[model samples]
Target: MIGRRLLVAAAAAGAGWVARAAWGTVPALGASRSAIRPYAAGSPRYRDNRFHNSEPSSSLPSGSQSGLAKAFLTRGATGRPRRAIPLAAPLAPTAAGELAVTWLGHATALIEIDGRRVLTDPVWSDRVSPSAVLGPARMHPMPMALEDLPTIDAVVVSHDHYDHLDQSTVVRLARTQSTIFVVPVGVGAHLRRWGVPADRVVELDWDESTEVAGLTLTCTEARHFSGRGLARDTTLWASWVIAGPRRTVFFGGDSGYTTRFADIGRRYGPFDVTLLPVGAYDERWPDIHMNPEEAVRVHLDVDGGLLIPIHWATFNLAFHPWDEPITRLLDAAADAGVTMSVPMVGQRIDGVRPPEQKPWWQGLA
Candidate 1:
């Protein structure tokens, strides 16, 4: 009798574990590998059965497996802020023919240029992983809800990383907004699988351009990789150039510093503004993610007028202190004599006439 009862308890525990695993994967793993292969096969970067970076890169450092494991186990409140992160009440941008940017946080910004608007790498979900219940959760609440955003002309995604390309957010945007999704090659498969209308997805390779709402959107080069699971780099990664008739903006979705920025500047630059990533960086992955100083260099290489930093202050993806990226960025920009805007999350800055710099992050540190 005792043996039978123990066997029954073990079976029940196993069943419970299976149910949890299934629940965690719902609508998160995205499209299957077979679905993405058709478009992935055509690009030159998509050789070796995977995408390749222009320069060699790795997501993590070498000789650091034990160090990484120790760091993860002992993060100990060092990666977050002691005080609450400040939030700004975001204003709806409506003035036409004016250039502006409202940084929503962590590589997600709403760019209003000329008469149209473009949203970059929008991830509204609470966590950025294959499982919402088990991943890096947001340290601060989003100041503005997704439903409250003004009508967007286009939505641009830079890569297939979970943080940049969220399944739930894509589904919600499909249901709520009529905006088209302009993504790097092979990303359309995920959108289609998530029920986004096929007509609404525009897949572009590097150096490709498409006109939308009187603005020219161009996909450019970036040194990064992409994947949602064990199978890696099955899609392309890119920086973007969004040019209006009167103004141009560069969206450095997420990239390490590469010489291509100078080429991009000469080809389609002298941009009115540049939004570059300035967070979640470490020595181990220098080739994949740029540090704050490198971002300023990219801004200069692109002949950017105003530099508004992104990819920080939202999720704690790296081991650095929460405010370190922006803090170091301020010092570097001052040294470089580069004009920059460090807006509070959700704060809107007029691209033409940005306000004076304020160290809003000082107190939070």
Candidate 2:
């Protein structure tokens, strides 16, 4: 009988350890709805106990619950590449230039404009989830180490999504760099929870602008939802307008198709370059994520010069093939006569004088 009791105890202890490991990063989930309400309540979009988009949008189509469930279970190997994806070694410039962008896979990119660098949606973790054990892991390794990045003037976070705003990366940057974090309103609560000093965080609502290192970072509108846990839309999500003395750039951080792009162009049009997302799209979530063709429309709507695509080629977040996004984007851009540069992971391209569009991704898919 004593032997039986000891065995049961051992089994229970093992289960407990597994549970602990799975939930170890729960604290990194960021501030709760109550903690964020104070900062978010003032916005016009905040009502009905949450933020709302300017246009009506649903995350998934009606009656898609069961179909999506079955799809998730049956869609094997739908979003992965056929073989290994190629990567390019990022070449660090001696100094910040007029305008250039180095894509570091997914939505992370370094934008150098007028002698300053701004990092957008910096996620450097192996997996993007509250728990380290489970989530969509990186398809390819990081082309460059996080510590090797050049001095950045500011880190701009579009929203609180696990993929876009990683808690581990935030903590590391806070400990290593002295740069301030510019985020949409209510997201500062997350940074504060992650041990980033309050002074180091700046929160802004739509249309608000903040200056960092002689550049203007404006929080613009986006059609997207925000949440880190169960409660949704407690914080704001946004696109950004980065304007320098000599150049301006538009960063479309995870948004759907919206006519607001025309409005933004009228206000802050004629950008030197625009970084738009071109992946993870589905008909079910049509209003929440734009397809590649819609991305081209956004660039033209904003009167952008050179278009560089982001938000693809890292983690698989959709049901389409891995390379389909870029493939469709190239065809659409060609039809629209849109000048674009599809850089390899970690490759930097000058916005003013971009290199020829290389078909490096050809045959890799």
Candidate 3:
């Protein structure tokens, strides 16, 4: 009896240690509940002590949680590529001319305009979850190492989702780079807690604009929710317009199709290029993520010159086949007479005149 009791205590102590390690290492929830209340006051979207989407949106459908879980476990397993994904060693941005974009997989990309580089939604972690030991791991290696990235003029964060805002990556950038971090309103709290200098962090609400390295960055509205933990919408989500003196580009962080694109086009139309999300969508949550066809429509609605699809090919967040998003996007672009570029993971695409469309993702299935 004594030996059995000792074994049970030892097992309990081991389980406690594992749980503590998993939960404690996640970055702090950043801002206290009281701190974010002030930002919510004047904002039109803020109501009843939480931020709401422009269109009534739901992350998951009613009574679909169980179905989603079962689908994910069964169908999600088939979403991975059967062969190794190719990676392109990024060319030096200095040689890519004034306006260019290098897709760094997932939603991360480096946009160079007028000699200044803006990194959008930079996530360099191996996994996109609170615990490193558990969660969705990368489908392919990063095209370029985080430390090897060229000096960036600015860093734009779309939202506070783990896949978008990685704490480990943020901490490293905070220590290594002097570049300014432009984020949605309440994400500044996370940066502050993660040791980013207050002066280096610039938080903006929708429709607000800030100047960084002689470029205009306007925060635009997006239909999504934000939270690193249980408390949701404490931070705002946004799309962005990056305009230089000579060229302009739009970065759609992650959003559903909305007429807001037309409004944006009227105010800041005819962009040289637009980076839009094109994956991780399902009918169950149609209002939150746009399908590939919808993405093309938003591109056209924005009066965009060149369309580059993002948010796919890096993580298996959805049950769709790995190549389906881009495949469907190609068909839609061909149908719409819209110019599109499907650069490899690290290939640099010229903003002014993108390379001819290539079926690079073929045979990798």
Q: Candidate 1's residue-wise lDDT over 1-365, tens digit each? A: 99999999999988877676467575677777888989889898888788898878887776888998798779988778899999999988455448999989888899999979899999998888877466788888888999988899999999989889998888898899999999999999989988999999999999999998998999999999888888888889999999998999999999999998899999998999999999999888899899999999999999999999999889888889888998899899999999999999989999999998888898786
Clashing pairs in 2: none
Residues 1-365, model 2: lDDT tens digits: 99999999999998987786578477878998888989998999899889899999898777988998888778888888888988999988879888899999999999999999999999999988888867788999999999998898999999999999999899999988999999999999999988999999999999999999999999999998988888888999999999999899999999999999899999998999999999999988999898999999999999999999999989988899889999999999999999999999989999989998788888867
TM-scores for all candidates? Answer: 0.94, 0.95, 0.93
Worst 10 residues of 1 by lDDT: 18-27
* Sequence-dependent TM-score of model 3: 0.93
TM-score sort, best first = 2, 1, 3
lDDT of each: 0.90, 0.92, 0.87
lDDT of 3 by residue, 1-365 (tens): 99999999999998987886498355644566566667656677778878898888898988988988888778845778988889888986444358999999989999999988999999998888877666788999998888988888899999988899988888888777899999988888788878899899998999999999999999998888887777888778999999999999999999888888888988887799999999998888888899999999989988998899899988899888889998899899989998888889998998787777778799876
Which candidate would rank higher by TM-score, 2 or 3?
2
Window of ten residues with lowest summed lDDT in model 2: 20-29
